[model samples]
Structure formats: C-alpha cells, structure tokens
Target: MEKETDSSEMFIDPVCLMKVDSGNKNLMFTHQTRTYYFCAESCRKRFAGNPDKYLSNKSPKRKGLWGRYLDRLNKTTGGKSLNCH
Candidate 1:
C-alpha cells in the first residue's frame, strides 16, 4: 500500500513549518530575518514597504541553533543556501 500525502504539505515553509495560505505562495521568500506568509502579492508588497516593523522578532544578530547553523553553512557553502538568507 502507498501512503497518501496532502498537496498542502508541499506548500509548507520549511523554516516555519506552517502551511502556506491559499493564495500567495509566489510572493514567498526568506528575507534576512523571518519567514513571512502572505495572502497576496499586495500583502507582501506592503510588508516590504516597512519590513522592519513586521520583522522585529527576527533580528539577524539574534543567537540560536539555527543562527549558528546558518553562520557555519554560510562559510562552507559560500552563502549558497537559501536558508542562510
């Protein structure tokens, strides 16, 4: 027997592990700090207009396991990893 997988599972963001909302997957990308989930391109645009306000919780200097991993990976991969940005 084969296991069934949901299509929604493919849209989940790996860093946040949250299902992408129905409409705006195309507007997705990881910025310097956090993983943003938008409902539309306009919403993402709005976010870009003042990213600092929305991304206050995602400081680049904030230290954690993920931060350390990104630092090491950045050095090894020459910053090729998408997650590093």
Candidate 2:
C-alpha cells in the first residue's frame, strides 16, 4: 500500500520543531495524555528524558541577522572573533 503525504498528518517534533510524519509510529512518545511525534530517535530521547524542557511556557528566542552571522562565524572560527577592516 502506498502512503499518503498530507500536510495535515504532519506533526511537529517538540524538541526541534521539525515536521514529523504521524504515520511513523516508531519515533513517537506519549506524555501527559498527548502523543508527540519525532523526526529522529535522538529528538524522541531528548523529549522523553525531559518533557518539561521542550513543553515549557517560554518560547525560543529569535536571533537577528547579525546574531545569526555571529553564531555562524563563531562556529566556523572556533570561537575566535575576526575583525574585517
């Protein structure tokens, strides 16, 4: 049988906020009477270990363009800041 790829059937992974297929029963966990789907086993394990961390009331902070650039720079330069003249 062929599986349908419907957006309505997609569930967000609580840990990473990635879209997960609801039909993928293997990468899912239940908590507080709600079933959470995951895109990977690592995300599922993280959520299962600390459900409250991902389910917290606080939303993720949005980083601006400069902030994103700095993050990428830091990652690529091994924490060494480079000044362009």
Candidate 3:
C-alpha cells in the first residue's frame, strides 16, 4: 500500500477522474507507490488483463493534444463533467 499523499500524485484516467467513486481499489492500481485511477470496472479489467500493454501505453509517447484538452476539461469541470468527445 502507498501513502495517500503519494497516491495523490499518480496519474488518473481522464474518464474516471470525473466520478466520485473513481478511486476505488478495484478500479485502480499503484505503480511505484503511485495510484492510478481507472474509468470503470471494464477498464480496470482490461488493464489487469494486460497491465504491460496499458502501462506501456501510459508513457508520454501515447499522450496527445486530445489528452491534454480532456485533462483541462476535467479540471474545469470540477471532476463532474461527462462527454465522449
């Protein structure tokens, strides 16, 4: 287990960050003591099915303008916004 402060610094799935229950352990992970939030049980399942795949995809190389935009939206929405855009 990781400290809450350390977990707070981890990356969160853009889709999950908007949900009140997004940080559930069943739908999250801790890598290097950093917590990661997932969008849903399915997303968590997918990640668990192949952690390497998702973990590898987590690198900066996989991020794009859309991701940044979504992150900005997440912050502005107060984590309550929802859009498949």
Candidate 4:
C-alpha cells in the first residue's frame, strides 16, 4: 500500500503556486521527497512535462490585480514594496 502521506498540511501547487490541501493525496504527486498538489488535470500535466520549471525557487510573480498594480509602481524603483508614491 502507498504509505499514507500527511494530508492535513496545505501546500501550493508547484506549477501554479496555488494553495492546496495536501491531505487530498488523490490529487497529488511526489517528486524528490516533495509533494505537489494540482487543482486541475491540465496543471498536473504541465508540471509533469517539466517539473524542474515549476519546482524552481525563482517562480514568476503572480499576476493578480493587486500584484499588477504594485508591479507598476515598483517598475521604476525596482522594488516589490507596496508604496504607491
């Protein structure tokens, strides 16, 4: 039997960086002692195609509305701060 992995902890999908409940082992895959969860099959497939890309620590910043607004302000300053001025 597959050793039951801890399901209570939540983790972000390496592919999308979206939070996921790790307890749902049915929706997860393991690689190099790390667990990855997927909110969709497409995301899972994308991760499988090139796990290294998604697993990298240098993940692209998420393009949420707030992030975009902050990025615009930081574009000239080269900072990630939230200060608009």
lDDT of each: 0.60, 0.85, 0.63, 0.75
Model 1: weakest 10-residue lDDT segment is 9-18
Candidate 2 achieves a global lDDT of: 0.85
Residue range 3-85, candidate 2, lDDT tens digits: 55563688889888878889888998999999999999999999999999888723457564568899999999999878687
Clash statistics: count for each candidate: 0, 0, 0, 1
Clashing residue pairs in candidate 4 are 7-23
Task: Give the alpha carbon lDDT tens digit for every residue of 1-85 in model 4.
Answer: 7867665777888777788887765677777887688877788888888888766645466465567777788896687565668
- Name the TM-score of candidate 4: 0.59
Q: Which stretches of candidate 4 lie over 4 Å from their true place?
A: 1-6, 57-71, 75-85
Candidate 3: stretches off by over 4 Å: 1-11, 14-22, 31-33, 60-85
44-72 per-residue lDDT for model 1 (tens digits): 67667776665554566776567888899
Query: What is the overall TM-score of model 1 with all chains considered together?
Result: 0.35
Shift in Å, residue 72, candidate 2: 15
